[model samples]
Target: MPNYIETDYKTDPAFFRSYIKPDLWEDSNALYKEYMSWENNKFFVQVIKQFDKPLLRQIKNIWNYMGIRPKEWRCNFFRVLPGGNLPLHKDTMSKISVVIPLTNMTGELYFEDGTEVLYHNMTIINTQVPHGVKPPTEERIVFHMGIHDTYFEEVKIGHNS
Candidate 1:
């Protein structure tokens, strides 16, 4: 199967942009300490907690529309600083992620198979695959939802429509 699949579902990037603030973000290395060894515990990436109920509701609605039902709700804002890149690695906690680029999303999403995606509206990415981000000209932020307990095949079928 493909490493990633684009979805028709789209949301207002402005809504997410409103929450962006320097103080709101926390170093991703601190949040996922277990994965620190993979990247030498670098602090290039940061994350913001998802707190807005309405935003969560909207994400849930989109999940439903895409025929995906997560066992639990987990959402966060992932920011990769300019000149920083996430080393190629597979996620252990979740197999799939719904990524919606919020700002300066010109970075490349590289997969182990040599496929690359430069721009995307909304996409479902296979986190189980070895993938990483290439440094971008500017900071990049994406709304990420980690989906568990749902088969990727089923989600792919929904997107195929």
Candidate 2:
């Protein structure tokens, strides 16, 4: 199976960009400190969880439209600064992640098998495989949701089901 699959679900990137501010982003390593070391924290990505109810509702509606149910609480905005990169590694928490590029997304999502994907729309990524972001030319923001209960195969085949 492919490491990632593009989805038909699309959204206005500007809508998501309106919610982002440099000060609002928090280091992801702070929340996952147990999994990373201080030395490696510099390359860790940032995240924001200040989305309003309306935005959350919209995301849930998108999930419903795609026929997938992701953990609502796990959905948030992920940011990677120009010089920062998320190292290639397998996820220990979730098997599947729904990623939607929101703003200044110049990075490439690459996998261990040498496949790379650019964020042009909504995509389902297999977090169980070794994958990470290539350092972007500018700050990149993506709406990410960790789907623990669903497998990638189920999502890849059930888009309209």
Candidate 3:
């Protein structure tokens, strides 16, 4: 056992609740004061190191579970609330995003061609795969881990990206 298990949306629960103990990512935002200063143009980014230790442990767990050792990476968090939506977009980075949902989300994920992915236990999210979020919820918080494109699970080759 792994903490994250894969399953199709139709068979998963749509509504549920899970409490995520804070890893104090606030510091990674460069303290609360600094975050408030630039909360407009940017939400918060490039500050993943502020909370690196625990996050690294988590990354190791996910990597081991995926059976891949990443060479380079970046990781962060997305604190989205109800009604918060991410517009459809594509990532140009050479790295992939690994997301571990910290809370329950009722929002649906819209793929490039408009497919719905409303499932949970999201351990990995391929940035190359165009996607977006719709109808967010306050309870939806996700831990995002970035992995170099050089490393990835072979099983997810046909599924993720």
**Per-candidate TM-score against the hidden true structure:** 0.83, 0.79, 0.62
- The alpha-carbon deviation from the true structure for residue 69 of candidate 3, after best TM-score superposition, in angstroms, is 1.3
> What lDDT tens digits, residue by residue, belong to model 2 across residues 32-115?
555445533334343555668878887777767657776533666777778677778888778788788887578899998999
Runs of candidate 1 with Cα error greater than 4 angstroms are 32-50
Better of 2 and 3 by TM-score: 2
lDDT of 2: 0.73
Best by lDDT: 2
- After superposition, which runs of candidate 2 have C-alpha atoms over 4 Å from their true positions? 32-52, 71-73, 156-161
lDDT of model 3 at position 38: 34
Question: Could you tell me the lDDT of residue 99 within candidate 2?
Answer: 84
Clashing pairs in 2: none
**lDDT digits (tens) for residues 19-117 of candidate 3:** 223544343234233313333222223235554464456556666656567777766566655654565655655345666555676777676766676
Candidate 1 C-alpha lDDT tens digits along 1-161: 67788776778888877766767677666666564465432233334454678776787777877677777646777787776667677877777888889986767999988988886678888888888887777878887878766655767345442
- Note the residue pairs that clash in candidate 3: 81-137, 82-136, 82-137, 82-138
Worst 10 residues of 2 by lDDT: 37-46
lDDT, model 3, position 16: 13
Q: What local lDDT does model 3 show for residue 12?
A: 17
